[model samples]
Target: LTTMALVPQVRDAVDLPVVAAGGIADSRQLVAAFALGACGAQVGTCLLVSEECPIHENYKAAVLKAKDSGTVVTGRIGGTPVRILKNPMAKTYIAKEKEGADKLELEEFTLGALRRAVFEGDVKSGSLMAGQVAGMLHEVRPLRAILEELCGGCRGVLERMEKEGF
Candidate 1:
């Protein structure tokens, strides 16, 4: 389900405050979360490309290059899927997992891959963990500018929506 569908249901089901997450990369999404009854939103992929993010340059570049179909999920056989950018290693992992390979073998094959990406800039084999919103990111930006855009852009979107009677 989309965030628009899930956030309201969660808000109504819980007694405590509900914070929305997933695919919340920009002001339009942030505003939608509020409209859906979320007290706040949590964003990650958008920030991963930020200048302040500690991930390796190759990882950030992969995120910046991502398209709508850029990410894939692995670990489905184990009933625990994770989304990461498409690459040789991810493709191989998905193939092995689908073939019902040993879980420990797959785990060993990808172990330290995250460190390889973040520290060694190994985009070809490292795990470039990201979200569906990876497609929305286009550039490397400083944290301040990214935050300002996310917050400041809301006024314009809100104004447009109000004018259109949203």
Candidate 2:
């Protein structure tokens, strides 16, 4: 499941720890995950723009410029949904899908799209994979700074919750 909607149900179904992934970009989301019965959170898109991330600057810029509505889930033509930024390449793919493009056609279009974005800095014609939480990210900070902010925010949130009787 790509959503935390399943976290509570899964946690209640078995005696196992649940790690939530997808759309978890900030400390508030982390707190929400815990409230939803998740013991841990896996962050992905948030790191793509990290200072330590080796992705091309174009990819990072695309992510940084994105808004909450900037991402779209394509790849249904290939039977696997992938969330990516709404760039020229994604728009073309979406248009093709709307016209009932075949799997082979979709594969051909997306082939090397990610590589182009990551290595060649072709944001317009490349696949910039991101999550809905991308808009929550603003800058490319160092890993240490990112971690510290998250932890500090988490603490602040916990303190507020405790004081407010949440």
Candidate 3:
């Protein structure tokens, strides 16, 4: 389930804290998660462009170049859906899926695709895993800067809410 849709439902169903994931990158998202009853937000794709991410430059470049429409959910052929950038590798996988490739064939095709993209900088033949928020990311900034922006954005949002009465 997507973050916004799932977080509240889970939060209401149980009394445990809910940590929302997927499509959460900025402070605005963080605030929205809390407003929707999430106790915290788990951020991943946004960090791919951070200086500390350790992914290949090619992977980072692909993510930086992505727009909201840049990502596609692949791996359906293997019965596991994954969101990744729309690169040559993803296109091939998608085409194969359309041709009714079996799960084993799909697995074989994607074997080492992630490693190639993450370590070998093979964007054309690699799996560039990312999220919808990849479009919001423009530059590779330090982790410190990213944290600061998120926190600052959250604080600003809270202040605005307080002034506007909730």
Q: Per-prediction TM-score, please?
A: 0.93, 0.92, 0.93
Q: Any idea what lDDT model 2 has? A: 0.88
Model 1: how far is 39 from its true place, Å? Answer: 0.7
- Give the per-residue lDDT digits (tens) of candidate 3, residues 2-93: 88788889989998888888998899899999989988888888899999999998889999999999999997657799999998889999
Off by over 4 Å in 2: none
lDDT of 2 at 25: 78
User: lDDT ranking from best to worst?
Assistant: 3, 1, 2
Q: Model 2: clashing residue pairs?
A: none
Sequence-dependent TM-score of model 2: 0.92
Leading candidate by lDDT: 3
lDDT of 2 by residue, 14-119 (tens): 8988988898877888898889998898889888988999999989998999999999999776689999999889999999999999988899988999999999
Better of 2 and 3 by lDDT: 3
- Candidate 3 colliding pairs: none
Per-model tally of clashing residue pairs: 0, 0, 0
